[model samples]
Target: METITTFGPLTPAAEIAAAFPSSVQGKNIIVTGVSPNSLGLATADAFACQSPANLIVTGRSYDKVEASITSLRSKYPNIQYHALIMDLASQSSVRDAAAKINQDDKIPTIDILVNNAGVMAIPALTLSEDGIETTFATNHLGHFLFTNLILPKIIKAAQRSSTPTRIINVTSFGHQFSPVRFSDINFSKRAADLPTAERPDLEKTEFFTGSSHAEDTYYGFFSYAQSKTANILFSVALNQRLWAQYGIASFAVHPGAVGTNINRHATPSEIEQALKRAAELGFDAASKTPEQGANSSVLAAVDPGLSLVDVAADEVTGVYIADCRVDDANVARFATNGHLAEKLWSLSEGLVQQKFE
Candidate 1:
């Protein structure tokens, strides 16, 4: 199927990886959330094939990180692979990981940072030790803190190289399902499960988060949507800031529907309903393999075309990309909300209890 952006039928990850031997070769890249059989793993795999100078695979478990390193070493025995343990679920873990990475003399700079780690559709309303909601903390706040901490390294790398630095935040097209729950993001009163009649107007039915899922139920879908929205807004705001101040390029990518660990949380009945809906939509395949799924992100990471945006007026360009091309953000107002982005940025700083400034 052709993408809405009109540029591709979706290039597979291998072809995309092989296409940019020059750009990716010898570049120091960090890919987060790379466990076995996952999106980040596939992405890191493709990147390793491109002969990166160093590939940093970061995840929650030391065993997982070691497993990824061992797996990648079998394929690219020569390229350097470093394992860094950083759990996105814990603020202290994130802080400790960042501090270690910064102090490491060997990892002096990073050319590309792919924020692909995320927690999705968690069935329960879990929170981090810092008391922030689970999905929001893992999907948004963890990346938020990690990025700010490593941003100096990315900047250092950009300063030395003539090329622009890149930060790719992997978001989801499902962002339309919900926006930031400004008043009660922590679910103090079960914001997602509030009485339908009393629920906020935006959640009731907006281009994003509005659905036929019943007016009085919580599906945990909207929680994921809200976090994805945070990803999009964060990209826009980050690009705008970094471009204005440092000239680095940042992007948000929707790595099409791909089969991965995220589906594990769904109940059998829920999965059945999803498959039924996908079948109803003209028998379209609801999911793709990790290679196919990693296209947009790999493209975002190496595509020379994305560099053109930085040349336009200011670094104020952050577009939602999918299937290897720039696509609409589905018109979710919050994606373009600078005020809300700034507010979320500030709120995130407090939640993680850290300030980049």
Candidate 2:
């Protein structure tokens, strides 16, 4: 049994970014889901202190966007900040935001794109405006569409720059709960959860794939896990394309157990139940502070260790990061399947009705 390991008391993102001043100085970076207190804000805030030429923060509401920008501006007056209105559940909103970002004259290039905004299990079956499952749409499809649309600016930044630009996807270990479901990727087909005792196959294989893992009784936990798996696979696919074409890099990180408002949509009963389950799994007491949890994301974004000449030799792009370090095989086997990643990419392009690759 792989015992659940308690990730450490990590160095805060501010401390980590201070060590690598050259990496972020005078660069353009964008972080999504930058509410008052979030992993995304912490990541962007750390870089802001380093005097980035442009730091963009985005959220679903204009009020949250302005509030975050206001708060960060108070702390780092020297940093140039921009706010964008984005709603990950709507493909049209994502496209509009991307178009606005691309046309901004002040933000000519994109040095880093941190896909850090995500929603947790809402404990219900809700669909986005595009008819896709809400959890899957916000967590995976939105970032997929956003990245493809903004990749040109990223490529431009990398081509005429001294360092490689990055696309960072903040995923989670819940990805181990399931794999990409090819037959019922959207949860439109067979949807139901089987009791653990009844599903003997689940006992044999620690991780199960496909619609078999979805909720028949509306088990939102599994739904969130499946969406997270999509995040990892997308990072794998995007990493391949970025490296081959633009000499850029993409990475995914399991930003260790953090206390945040991602569970805002969960009902009180659902929240209590989740806490109880986390306690049973030894995950509750092991949680890191929001700032500490943001360390892995900051590390993935700008760590001198990742810029070594030997980094590419190790194929660091497709790997997953945890505890502020990259681990070769911490992710499930399916996450590394190139063919499957490509298939998911194709499915994602179809969902958004746009093809940028």
**How many angstroms is residue 68 displaced in model 1 relative to the true structure, after the best TM-score fit?**
1.4
For candidate 1, what is the lDDT? 0.75
Lowest lDDT 10-mer window, candidate 2?
A: 197-206
For 13-79, candidate 1 gives per-residue lDDT tens digits of 7678677666588889999999898999999998999898989999988998899889999999999
Clashing pairs in 2: 192-216, 193-216
- Model 1, total clashes: 3
Tens digits of per-residue lDDT, candidate 2, 226-297, equal 778788778778776777667776778888667789867656664555445556665533667778888777
Which has the greatest TM-score? 1
Cα-based lDDT for every prediction = 0.75, 0.74
